[model samples]
Target: MVDDNKFKALVNKYVELSDQIAEVGAELVALRKKKDAMGELVMQVMQQGDIQVLELTEQGGKLIRRESKRTEALKKEHILDELMLLTGNDATRAQASLEKIHNKRTLVVKDALSRKR
Candidate 1:
């Protein structure tokens, strides 16, 4: 003899926990927004003041942030031609090669809520 009351109570508790999870997720999103804003502010201040490292209070850690300015990049449109020129116009017997080697593969998984239409 199974109790209907216990089963219903279990379902109610599950719904309550699901709602709590959503609330916590929202809080996390809000916290991330504030954190990103603070980071941008700190970077702006440092760049404007021509500063590198900013020392904080005794309890706080020092923040060392800098903008990386890329000086040059290999042109992809001229890669084969560039390789051809370097190889003395011989690709089959060329010692140099224009190659892009990927070291690893990454897999991404996303979780989203879908409503039935």
Candidate 2:
């Protein structure tokens, strides 16, 4: 009886926490959209003005524009093609081998509570 009660309490706590997290997640998505939009606007304004640093005396800070370069992401198709080359251009065998490796990977499971609509 005690164990059952403890389990029930934990499940209730989990649901409550999940609800709070969901609310916060929605707010975070909205905030990120706004931030991205503002960043785009700032980039456009700085580029138009040919400005590197915008000093705000009242705000006591400045915005600096910096450039960055990075390579593209390593996609699944690229990896599969490389694997096919290694497997002597045997696409089917390579795919099967990859699937076997994927299936052998360890997975962790935990108890979770969700609200039913």
Candidate 3:
């Protein structure tokens, strides 16, 4: 009887925490959208004003404008194109190579909770 009560309590706590996390997750997504929009606006302002750095005297901080490089993830089409090129434009060979690579890659599985509506 005691064990059953304890198990029920743990499950209840887990459900409550999961609910709180989901709510916060939603708020974070909304906040990120707003922040991204504001960031674009700030970038435009900085560009127009020809300002690279803005100092906040009260906040004891400064915002610095900088450029960053981002690399795009490799897609299947890109891989296929490259493989076909390497294989003398042989589609079948390229596909076989792609399949071989995919087969050799490791796969992992883990348990997760799915929220019910």
TM-score for each candidate, following the candidate numbering: 0.45, 0.62, 0.87
Residue 16, model 3, lDDT: 95
lDDT of 3 by residue, 8-88 (tens): 998899889999999999999999999999999999999999999999899999989998999998788899999999999
Q: What is the lDDT of residue 30 in candidate 3?
A: 100
lDDT tens readout by residue for model 1, 1-98? 54999989986787777888889999999999999999999899988898899888886989898667975765544666766787788875332344
Clashing pairs in 1: none
Write out the backbone clash pairs for model 3: none
The local distance difference test score of model 2 is 0.88
Question: Which candidate gets the maximum lDDT versus the true structure?
Answer: 3
Q: Is candidate 1 or candidate 2 better by TM-score?
A: 2
Which portions of model 3 miss their true places by more than 4 Å?
Answer: none
Q: What value does the lDDT take at residue 28 in candidate 1?
A: 97
- After best superposition, candidate 2 residue 104: deviation in angstroms? 11
Ranking by TM-score: 3, 2, 1
Q: Which candidate achieves the best TM-score against the true structure?
A: 3
For model 1, the stretches where C-alpha displacement exceeds 4 angstroms are 1-7, 66-117
| lDDT to native, each model | 0.73, 0.88, 0.92
Which residue pairs show collisions in model 2? Answer: none
